[model samples]
Target: MKKTLLAAAALAFTAGLAHAGDTVRMGTEGKYPPYNFINDKGQVDGFERELGDKLCAMESLTCTWTTNDWDSIIPNLLSGNYDTIMAGMSITDERKKTIDFTQAYYPPAFSAYLGKDAGANIKGVVAAQVGTIQADYVAKSGATLLEFPTMDDTIAAVKNGEADAVFADKDALKPFSKAEGGDFVWAGQEVQLGEGIGVGLRKSDTALKDKLNDGIGKMKADGSLNVLLKKWFGDETPTF
Candidate 1:
């Protein structure tokens, strides 16, 4: 009886170990600047990366990040190709139907960039990259929509007069606008986009979702979240 009880206890301990150290694969579009972009050394580095690292550390889980295109990210997550997504995806009603999201990690703000000759007639003008929230806004708002695979291409389209304007997160647009001298200008006020950014997880993975949220709340309370935000956005805390 003593030996049997010891074996049962060992089995339970092994199960707990398996549950605690589970590895989570995170998906990201490594093209979005200051969020999850690829560095010159061919490594993924950005705000999302830092946040993911912290979450994994806090939760005692191993994390692996996979870089993928923006359009296929959601499908990939749903297919179980990854365990979660830390791609700075916003929590939207449309997406909530398909997957669950953790508490927001960053705020959302939208801005538009126009070419030198382009006036502020944003109506009917093509703006935003494909598969992005800005593109969704353009489609729903009856604006002429132009889609590009990457932010660089979208910026190039505006600079070369191919597209009238490009809309994206304000933080992502700031560096490009500054580099353009008088060639480009931000038009209109920065619009409050939505309820910040969050980690996207599979709908059935409620356990992992709870863990991520708890980790985020701890990060917020300890000021680690703010430290990471300042590293990426300088003095500005993005509007959530």
Candidate 2:
């Protein structure tokens, strides 16, 4: 009886160790500006990168970042290449089908941009980035759709008259428009497309999910999240 009790205690201790030291590999499309872009220094620098660093510190876990194309991020997560995703991904009902989301850390909304010479009559018809809620809205709202791999390409399509307008997140459009010599205009009111952005994790890892949620909540309560947001948006709070 004594031997059995000792062995049971040893097994429980091993299990606890396994849970405590687990590493989380996070994936993101490092090309989206103001969120997960690769800077000129050849390093990832953006709101999501900063936020992920904070979460890792709070959770007392080792975190790693890997870059992939935006379209492939979800599939890579499902295949277990990464434990979580922080690619400025919005929490939507459609995405919730495959992976679980942590508490939202950033707002999610869509804005439209038009070229200087584009007609206002083409205002309501525009293309949005593929695999986004903006694309879904365009499909349902009778807008013509032209998909692109990056926001820069989408904006260029409008500027060159290949497409009349482009729809994407406000954070993305704001910087692009300012840098491009004021060639684009924000059309209509910005659309609140979904809930805030969250970390995507595999459905089987409920323990890690809970850990991340707690860490994010702590970041918010301690003002770390706001600090990162201001670094990206400069006095504007991200809208969900």
Candidate 3:
């Protein structure tokens, strides 16, 4: 993993979707393990949870978590269903058109292809979460794309013989690949894409954006962010 801080985006999104609430609502897809998920306790839990909590504390903001399906996560944010999107959402110019993003907390990592056969052809059927960059890639790469409403379904497609493989953030898919034993392996070379993940806020909420950025800057300076990244993903993922 390359150790670096992704630059802050010089942009704003949804200037009309301003938020005013006592509690910061952090929306997530609670299925991306190591990043965000519902633990055995049934509460929102994972690396982002810990990091979001820390960031909220830094800004002295009260925060609450909401789990939503991945496909509608961004639209929900725009609709004021939540105050911010803290899922493992990568910062991209396309997404920047819909919502503003903070400087990346996690640097961009590789997009991995996982499958039952190590020799699966890249042109074979590929499964990816709907509305993801991975899905878009497969659609344009000549591979038949089988879009799922969630990440779990994408993996299920590969497991159920519906897809030759699943494509997603390498680190986001690490736990699944490992848990699949030898049934699934990294089928092809990894591809890195987009800016890293960040906290997504409405464009009108620059105040909230600055506070979160300030918190992230403090964590980067004190090495706390690095510690959390290492804790969740080991030394394999890039850190601040």
Best candidate per lDDT, number?
3
Local accuracy of candidate 2 as per-residue lDDT tens digits, 83-130: 788887899999999988999998665555554443443445576677
CA-lDDT, candidates in order:
0.77, 0.76, 0.85
Local accuracy of candidate 3 as per-residue lDDT tens digits, 121-150? 668899999888888888998999999988
Q: Predictions ranked by TM-score, top down?
A: 3, 1, 2
Error of 3 at 140 (Å): 1.9
Worst 10 residues of 3 by lDDT: 3-12
The residue ranges of model 2 lying beyond 4 angstroms of the native Cα positions read 1-20, 117-125, 178-182
In terms of lDDT, model 2 sits at: 0.76
**Which residue pairs collide in model 3, if any?**
none
Candidate 2, 193: how far from true, in Å? 0.9
lDDT by residue (tens digit), candidate 1, 1-240? 999999867754443333345788778889887888989988888999888988988998898878988878888776566778887687888899998899898866555555443365566466677877778877776668888888888888777777777778777776776453435777655667767789987766788889999999998888888888888887766532
- Show where candidate 1 strays beyond 4 Å: 1-21, 179-183
Clashes of 3: 0
Distance from true position, residue 221, model 3, in Å?
1.3
